[model samples]
Target chain A: MNGKYRFLLAALPLAVVIGLSGFFYDRLGKDPGELPSVLIGKPVPEFTLPGLEDGAPGLASADLRSGTVTIVNVFASWCAPCRIEHPMLTALAKVPKIRLVGIAYKDKIEATRAFLGELGNPYALIGADVTGRVAIDWGVYGVPETYLVSPGGEIVWKHVGPLDETVIRGELLPRAEKLLK
Target chain B: MKFLLRLSSPRRRPGPFAGRVPLSARDPGLRRDDARGWRALALATVLFLSAVPALAIGVDEPMADPAMEAKARDIARGLRCLVCQNQSIEDSNAPLAADLRHIVRERLAAGEDEAAIQKYLVDRYGEWVLMRPPFEPATYALWFGPAALLLTGVGVILWRRRHPATVPEAEALTAEERARLDRLLKDEDPA
Candidate 1:
C-alpha cells in the first residue's frame, strides 16, 4: 500500500507538468487577438439600412442571397485602418465575379462620401449604418471587419483587421475562389 | 548593532553657548513633522488613485430620475465592451462602448426591461456581449468546474487519510546479522 501510494504521488507531478505543457503548447502559434466568430457557418443576421449614396437603394439581408459569394466589409471614415485597407479593397473590386459591399459603420454620410471621393470608392453598394445597429447584427467588434458570405447567405469567413496585400492575395482570394468552385 | 551604536554616541551641541540636549527632546518634533508629511502624501495618493477612473473615462449623461440612472448603470455594468474586451461598457471609454451605453439608456427610457435589453444585445453580438454569461448548458462547465475541482480535491485528501498506507513487511535478519546487532547493543549498553 505504501509503495502504491508513493507511486501515485510520483505520477501526480508528472501528470500536472504534462497537462500544463499541453495547455501552453496549444496556445503557441495562435494569435491571442484572433477571437473566433460565434456567427461562423451561421446565416447572416437580418438588417436593412439606408444607402450612403444619394437615391441608392439600401442594402438588406435578401440582397446578399443573390446566388453569388459576397464580401461584406464593415468600415468607417474615422477609422485609420479602414483608410489603409481601402486601396486593397479597390484592387479587390477589379476582380471579376466578386461582389463587394461596404457598410459605413457609425459615420456621417458626408464624411463617408468625402472619404470615398479621396480614396476612390471600391464598393458596389455602400450602406450607412449611422446608429451602428446593422454592425451589431453582424457581430462586428470594431471597424474594418470583413466577412465572406456564401451564395446561400451563410457567413463563411470573417477577418477582424485591415486586409493587407498579403492577406488579400493569400487568404481572401483563395477562399473566395474556393467558394466560387 | 546600528541602533546600539547610535544610542551610545554623544549628542552634538547646537552652539558653543548651549549645553547638549537629548536626541528625543530635539528631534521628536522633526519626526512628527516627517510622519505628518507622509500621511498627507499617502492620503493625496489614495485620493488621486480613486479619482482616476471617474476622470479618465467620461460616462454618458445620467438620466433625470436617480432610480432610472442607477438601473442604467447596473445594465451597463453587466454588458461587455466589444472594443475593450476586459472592460465592461460602464467602465470603457471606447466609442463603441459609449454607443452601447447610449442604447441601453434609450431602451431603459422606453420602458424596456433589463432582460429584453440584454436579449436585444445578445441577438446582435451573441451571448459574448454579456459580462456574466447566463446559466445555460454551454456554460455549465465554466460555472461549476472550479467547485467540482475543489470537491474532488477534498474527497481525495479525505480518502487518503481514511485509507492510510501501511508499511510493507520487512525481511527477516540472518543469524550472523542478528548476533552482530546483539554484540553492538551489548557494547553500547552502560548497564
Candidate 2:
C-alpha cells in the first residue's frame, strides 16, 4: 500500500465503527413511540368541527386564525392519558392570550361532556370528532396530541403524548411565548 | 423500499395498559407487564400478516364499482396503517386503518384519480404515508445512498487493482539456508 494515504485506509474501519455507534446510540435514547410529525412548521389543516353539543359554538379553522395563539388538544373520553394531561391544559388556559381548544376524538358526545364536566372544562371551545375525520385532517394518530398553533395559524410546536409539567414548562410555554412576541 | 422493509416506527400510542385493564382489574400483578406482552404479540401478528398477502380485514365494505374498488385496493396497498406501522391500510385490522380504507374508497367514488387520492393523504399525513417516499431533496440520500456506497466501493477496488501494492522482494538465502537447501535436494527420493 502507498505509505502517504495508508493512515486514511487504516482509519476507515474505525470511522465506520464510530459512525454506526453514534447512530445506534442516538436511536437508543429516542422513545420509539414518538412519531416525528412533518406538520411542525406548516399551517394547521383546514377543518370545521361541530361543537361537542348542538347548541354550543363549533370550532373552525377561522377560530385558530382569529389573531390568538390557540393550544389545540386532541382528546377522547376513551383515552386514559387525556385525564393525566388535563390539569396542565387547565393551567395553560389560565395564561392570558392563549386559547386552549379541545377536540374530542372518536368519543360519544355525552361521554365527552361527562368527562369534561368531571375534569372541570379548561377548554375555551370543544369540538366533537364523532367520525374522527377532523382528527385525520389534523394528522392525529391517537388521543392526547397537543399542538401550539400561532396566531397566524402555523403549528409552532406539537407534543404527541400526554402533557406533563416538564413539557408545559419546558416546551409549550416557551414556544407559545415566543410566538406571542 | 429497503428502509420501508425495516418495520416498527413510532407514532405515539395510548398506554395500551391504561386502555385495557380487564385482567388487571381483578389480578393486580398482571397489569404492569401486559402492555409489553401485547406489543410483542401485535408485532408478531403484524409480521405474520405481512408474510402472507395484504389480506382485507373483511371489516371494510367495498365500493360498488369493481374498477373503483380495485383502484382503492391498489392505492391502499401503498398507504401505511399508522397504528400498525409497516402494515398497509388494507392489511391492518385497526379502526383507523378502516377509516383510511373507507376514505380511499370514498375518494375513488368521487371520481378522483390516483394522484389526487395520494395528494389528499400526503396533505394530511405528509410523505410518510406513502410506503415509497417521493424523490425530493430531503430524501435524496435515502433514494441513492446505497448506490453511492456501492460505486465508491467499486472505485476503490478498481483503483487498488490498478495501483497494486508493492510486495517485498524475496531475500537472498544465507549460507545456512543454501547449505540446507542443497542437503534437502540431495536427500530427495528419486522415482
Residue A40 displacement in candidate 1 (angstroms): 3.7
* A18: Cα error in model 1, Å: 4.6
Clashes of 1: 0
Candidate 2 colliding pairs, count? 0
Off by over 4 Å in 1: A2-25, A41-62, A108-119, A164-181, B1-57, B163-191
What local distance difference test score does each model get?
A: 0.85, 0.84
Every candidate's chain B TM-score: 0.69, 0.59
lDDT of 1 by residue, B102-154 (tens): 88999999999999999988876778889999899999999999999999999
Candidate 2 positional error at B168, Å? 3.3
Q: Model 2, range A64-109, lDDT digits (tens) per residue?
A: 9889999999999889999988888888889998899999899999
Pairs in steric clash, model 2: none
For TM-score, the strongest prediction is 2
Best by lDDT: 1
Q: Model 1: per-residue lDDT, tens digit, A19-138?
A: 999999999966775667888899998888789767888788997999988999999999999998888898888899889999999999999999999999898888899988778778
